[model samples]
Target: MRSLIKIYRATADRVTGRNLDKAAARKQLRILEEIEFVCIGAVAFGLFLEMPSLCSAASLVAFGVLGEFVIHRFHVRASKREQNLSDKESNEQLAAIAEVNLKAETERLKRVEIEERRAPRRLSMEQFNIIESRLRAFAPVEIGVIPTAKGDAEPLEFAADLCVLFRKIGWLPAFATRIDHTIRLGLWVELSPNADRLAQRAAPELVVALRIAGIAVDQDVSRPAGGEFGGTGEEKERACGAGIILNVGLHPVTARGY
Candidate 1:
């Protein structure tokens, strides 16, 4: 199919170069007609002279000329047919390509629409109750809800909601701190470099609490964010003895769990 198109294009280009588009191979047809006429006159003259040799020769030439005319006529028709076939098939191929491209673009637009409707990962009221009850065992622990910066607001919104919950639980700071840091993705647990055994012991329980409520926390326990913030707190009774940071990050395309 491809080769046929190529041949057709090349032939068309040559025809165009010689200005054959309008001429319709008329010149060649005229030349063949003239030759046939001359052959017919020769045969007639030979027969009038009563010469068998001349008559036979002229008769053979006339037949050959007739054959040439027929061959040329059919060749033109055949070429026309080939050109028409090429044109039709080429149009069909282009139409198919255009349709495929349009389908792909339509799919892309659908994905964009879905993304627009997609809501951020949320924590429900029942999950909140479960988490609050679980945290009661790790009360007095300090938590800094830090949400990472991203192009989309989904992470920020989710982080803000989670921050409100932690604040209401009385373990987090006033609000979530917005920081420009390139760190690990998804829900991560960050521990202070100076975090004592109390924070270490509470880390597993915290993971369980979040997971039990169906909140996906990705990592086990990562060290502090390169000492970006001090884990130490005010030394007093009921103060945060076990300090941990919940680094709220962008949601992953695929959800993972323990």
Candidate 2:
């Protein structure tokens, strides 16, 4: 009988696509065992009480088959439920990741828009040519333009004008924007430590010339701000070597300093 039971279990395991050691298979087997025991007890009682022997045997067989079917159905339902839950969890995780990526992309695009808005305006060809000619006469100074935050379009326009003017003069000028509390209006010259003696001497005359050209000028030459050129503060200072920084602000051009 034990050998027959083992054979039955092995066959059932293969048919049901489950291992007898697994939880689902073990649960089904336990329930089936209980049903078989109850059925056998009923048959034995019927025989001892002189009831119909055939009917008792038939009842035992029917109960055994029914129990097996019920347990199999239960296992199938449980497996399906577990699968659905797993799928739901996977979907939720994917949705969360996608949402985070979308938010990051949106923020990146927003930053790009702000930068585009802050970009400097272009200078016309005629204005470019004139400024270029004027800047060419002051070549070898390696000037840079730094616009103030509050200067609005005026500073940007001045920087653009300087770029074209300096480019025409055969000098590629560095251009950048910075925030300064003390600066309100006017164009100031910042001299680097390596600046030649001639540039230092010409600085005062350059300021006078700028003032005469309908531009407000800073009276004294100053040092470049920490990060006035580009990159980090130290990098900007290093880049400003032996060069002049032209700071453009919002104030209207006047006969004298603002």
Question: Measured by C-alpha RMSD in angstroms, how accurate is candidate 2?
Answer: 18.0
Instruction: Please provide, for model 2 over 1-258, each residue's C-alpha lDDT reduced to its tens digit, 9 standing for 90 to 100.
Output: 334434444433333233233455556556655765665565555445554577876665666556557656765655554454444445555555666676788899999999865664344566455544454555555555666563467457656676767666665466766666553445556544445554454445455555445454544334433222211222221111122246322111210232
Candidate 1 TM-score over all chains jointly: 0.39
TM-score of each: 0.39, 0.34
Best by lDDT: 1
Q: Residue 115 deviation, candidate 2, in Å?
A: 26
Which digits, one per residue and each the tens of the lDDT, describe model 1 over residues 136-242? Answer: 66545555555545344666666666666766765533234444444434455655455455555555666668778876555433333332322232322210111
Alpha-carbon shift of residue 8 in model 1 (angstroms):
50
lDDT of each: 0.53, 0.50
RMSD of every prediction? 12.8, 18.0
